[model samples]
Target: MSNFVEFTFRGQPGYSEPTAREVITSSIPVRTIAIYCFDPRAADAAQAVADYFGDEVYPGDLVLDEADRKIGSTATVFPLIVGGGRAADALRSITVSQHLFGIERVVVVHHSFCGATSFTAEGISAAWKHEHHTDISSLYDWDGISIADFEKSLNYDVSLIRNSPGTPKHIEIYGLFYDIGSGELTEVVRDVPAKVA
Candidate 1:
C-alpha cells in the first residue's frame, strides 16, 4: 500500500523475489567493493582503485532498455563512501553486496590529510559531550573513531573486515593508504584466503 511500491521489483506483477534477484545479478557485473572517505578530494578513489586492479570499470555507462528506462550499469567496482572509510561502517554493505552481486574483493582506502586524522578519540568524545550534551565515548570503538596512523588504521580495518561473520571467508580484503596530494595508493595489508584443498 505505499504509493511508491510500483518502483520496487517486488511490486511488479508476476515477479517474485528470486526472479528479481536473478535479474539484478545479471544486470550489473560488480566484482569489487571500494570503501573510501566521502571527501571530494577522495572522490576519485574508486577510479584509482579500478585503475590499480586493471580489470574493473568505474563510472561506467548506464544500460537502457527499449523504453529508455535505466536497467543496469557496465561498472564492475562499487564504491561505498563513509566517514574515515572505516570498515565498521561498511560491514553491512559488504554483506549486502555479496548477497546481491557476489563481490570478490573489498578495498579499504584511508587517505592522507583526512579529517578523521585531525582529532583523537578522546577529544571528539569530550567535544561531543560539551557541545551536544551526550556522552558518545562508548558509542563507538576508540580506534575506529579516528586514524592515528595510516598503517595501523588500515591494518585494523582489514582485520575487522576479515573477522566479521558477515564477510565471506573466500572474499579477498585489502587495506590501502591513499596520498591525496600524490594520488598514489600504497598497500598496507592484504588478506587473501587460502585455497580450499
Candidate 2:
C-alpha cells in the first residue's frame, strides 16, 4: 500500500481507469479503533490470535498502529486493553493520537457480551487507575457514553481536536458496536468514536 494519505475509494491510478481484479480495503482501511476486551494484552497479542484471519498485528505503538491509518499506508489496529468497561481513558488518549498523527477518524467498538461493557463506570475508573498507575482526574466522562452516544461525542471530540491549537482540525471520529454473538458490526453513530475490537 502507498504511504497513508487520505480515506476514500482509492483503488485506481487513473481515478477513472479500473483494474481487472482490484481488491478493496487496500485503498481504504480503518481509521482508528478503541476496544474494551477480556484480554489485557491486546493488539499484537490479539493479532497473534487474529492471524488465523490473515491480519498483521500492530502492537504497542498507538499512533503508528494501523486502523490508526496515519503515516503508514497499511491497515493498522491499536489495542488499548481497558479491561471490562467503557474505555473512556482509552478514548481520551486516542484523541491525542488523532491530533498527534493526522488520522482522519476514530472508532469505538463494544461487543455484545463483553466483559468490559458489563462493568460500571466506577469499576472502569478503578481499573484504569490500577492498570495505568494514574489517577482518575486526568480523564473525561463516558458514564453516559454508549454506542448511542457516539454522534454527540464525535462532534464534541472533533471540536476538541479542531479547537486544540496546532491540531490538523479536519479529522472525523465515529463510534460503533460489534455483536460478537451475531458476528455483526453495527454502526451506532456515523463519524463518531468506534467502540469495536
Candidate 3:
C-alpha cells in the first residue's frame, strides 16, 4: 500500500501571512465504480488511463489464469486484466459492484488491434484442442476475433449486464474503443432506447 503525498497551507483566509507545511502523506481517497476493459496489455493501458485521469491505480485481475499478478485497476475508466473476448464473464462483477456501491454508470472499454480478434473459430479450436488435448470447439462461442467483432462484442457484453434481471434497469452503459497506437478513446454509439412518454 502506498501513501498519498499532499500539500497544505496554514494561514487565515485572505491573509498575507501564510505558512506552508511540508508535504504530508495520507491514505489514498476511496473511489466509486470503474470502467470494465479487456486487453492483453490492459495493465499498462490502465496505468496510463489512471495517470491521464489523475487517479491512483491499483491492481486486480478478473481472471486468474496467471500468477496472481496485477492485471488492472478500479481507480478510473480503465482496463482490467481479462482474457480476450471474455468480457461477458465479468457481468457478475458488474452486478455486484453496482449492488454494493449503487453504481449507475459503467463504461466498457475495448481496444483496437486486440489479440482477441486475431483468431478464427477453427484456429482457436485447433489451438485449444492441441494445447489441452481436449475438444472445446463445440462449447466455445467466440468464433472470429476481428475489428468488426470489436464493437459487436462490446455491445453484447453491455447487453449481458444491462439485460440481466439481477442488474438494475436504470444503469447507464457506455462503450469506448481505445486505439493502442494513438492512445485515443473513441465513443461507440449504437441506437439508444427512446425514453418512455
Candidate 4:
C-alpha cells in the first residue's frame, strides 16, 4: 500500500488545499478510532498514550524500550480523522469512514469554549446569502450549527453517530468533555467504557 492516505478537509473556508494526503507510519497500532475536535487547545491523546505507556505498546521516536527489536514492528497510530462536526461535510466524512473501516470503537471528544459556538444562525445565513446570492434561509438552521454547550452538543453528536445508518451497530461510540482550563478529559457517556486500554 502507498505510504500516504488521502484526506479531504471539508467546510474549512480558510484551508488552502481542498484535499491532502497524510503519510502513515508502520508503528502505532490501530485498535481504536479516536475522534477529537480540531481545536489546538486540546492535547493529542494518541501521542500522550504513546508517551506514557512506553513505545513497546505505542512506539514513538523518544521511546527507547527494546528499540532494536521494535524498529520496524514498533507501535504506532492508526488513521485519525479530525474535524469540526458543526459542518455537514465533516459529519458525512466521519460517517463514511465508520461505515467502511468498521472500527471497534469511537471516542468523540468535545472541548470547552469551542469556536463553533461563536457562529450564530444569522451570521451563517448572512454569509451564505452573501456568497451564493440566494435565499437558503429555510435550508439550514443556525441553532443546529452552533455549539453553545459542550456537554449537550457532545451527547447529541454521540447519539447522532449511534443512530446513523453508516455506523455499524456493533461499533461502540463514546463522548468526552475536555475542560480547556484545567486540561482534563471527562466521560459524558458512562454506559460504555471510553478509556483506551
Candidate 5:
C-alpha cells in the first residue's frame, strides 16, 4: 500500500500556492464523470483538462490505462489512481470491470510533439520494444489527423465496450488534440454516444 499510494492533494506541491491552495482546501468537486486522459505525459495533459473544466480528477492509471485517481470535494478536484495498466487496454478495460474507475464520457487527449505520434508507427514499435524490452507489435492508435480519425479510435474503443455484457449504457465519448507547446486543447470531436461501455 505504501508503494502503491500516490499524492493527489494535501501533500502535493501545487498545494503551496495560496490561491491554488485555497482552491484545493475549499473542498472542490471533481466534475470528471470519467476522464480518459491519454498521452505519454498523461499527468500534465490531465491537469490541463482538469483546469479547463475546473474539476478535480483522480488519477486512475499511469500511462496506457484509462481513468484517473479522482481529486477534491463537491466543487473541488478529485483524481483517482489505478494500479499500473496498459494504455491499449483502457477502453476495453472499462468495457468489463477491469478498469479501476467505471466508464464514463472520456476526454481522449493526445498532445502535439508527443513521441507517441511523432515517430512512424514502425519507429515507435522499435522504440517501445527497446525501452520496455519486449518484441513490441504495433500498439499506438494514431490520432494526429482530423477529429474523424480521433473519433474513429474512440468509436472502435466503444465498440469493444459495447460487445461486453455489462458495459455502461449512457456514456458519451469525446476526442481532442492538445497542443503541448501552446498549452491549448482543441476539440477534435464533439460529444457522441459511445457504443456502450
Candidate 6:
C-alpha cells in the first residue's frame, strides 16, 4: 500500500527472497567488509585495508545496465563507518553483508587519537545523566564505549566478531590500528578459523 513498497525487492511481481539474494550476491564482487571510525581524517582506512590485502578492489567502478541504470559494482571492499569503529555497532551489518554479499573477510580498524579515546564509559554515562536526566550506564557494554588501549580494544573487537553467531565461522577477522598522522596500519589481532582437516 505504501509508495516505497514498489521500490523494494519484495514488492515486485514474481519476487522471491532467495532469488533476490542470489542476484545481489552475483552482482557485487564484495569480498571484504572494512569497519572504521567515522572521523574524516581516517577516511582512507578502507583503501588502506584493500591495499594491505593486495587482492581487493576499493572504490571500484560501477556497472550499469543497458538503459544506463546503475546495477552493480566491481568493488570488493565495502566500508562500514561507525563511531570508534566498534564491533558492537557493526555486528548487524556484518550479518546482513554476509547474508547478501558473502564476505570473506571483516577488517576492524581503530585509529590513533580517535575521539573514542577522549572519554571514559563512566564519564559519558555521568554526563548523559547530568545533561539529559537519563541513566544509560547499563544500556551498553562499558568496555566497548571507549578505547583505553589499541591492542586490547582491537583484540576485544576481533573476538567479539568471531564469537558472534551471525558471523560466518569460515570468514577471517582482522583488527588493525591506523595512525591518522602517518597513514599506516598495524595489525594488532588476526583471527582466522583453523582449516578443517
Question: Per-residue lDDT for 1-197 in model 5, tens only?
Answer: 36533444445555655555455434343334333444445455566666665545544322221355444334222322221111244544444322333334555565454443334556656777889988656343433222224445545544544444555655554455667677777766555553644
TM-score of 1: 0.98
Q: Considering every candidate listed, which one attains the maximal lDDT?
A: 6
- Show the colliding residue pairs in model 1: none
lDDT for each residue of candidate 4 in 1-197, tens digit (9 for 90 to 100): 34342332333344543121121122323444455556777556545333322432343343334655332333343324354443233456556554433345556666677777777667777888999898777885444456778777777777777766666666666667766677667777633535556
For model 6, how does the per-residue alpha-carbon lDDT over 1-197 read when each residue is reduced to its tens digit?
A: 88799888899999999999998999898999999999999999999999999999999999999999888999999999999999999999999999999999999999999999999998999999999999998999888769999999999999999999999999999999999999999999999989999
Weakest 10 consecutive residues of candidate 5 by summed lDDT: 77-86
What is the clash count for each candidate, in the order shown?
0, 24, 1, 6, 40, 0
Better of 5 and 6 by TM-score: 6
lDDT values, one for every candidate: 0.93, 0.45, 0.52, 0.54, 0.46, 0.95
Location of the lowest summed lDDT over 10 successive residues in candidate 4? 18-27
lDDT of 1: 0.93
Per-model TM values vs. the true structure = 0.98, 0.42, 0.58, 0.58, 0.46, 0.98
Please provide, for model 2 over 93-141, each residue's C-alpha lDDT reduced to its tens digit, 9 standing for 90 to 100: 5655554343554444455544533555566678878999777643655
Q: Which stretches of candidate 5 lie over 4 Å from their true place?
A: 1-42, 54-87, 92-103, 124-134, 138-167, 194-197
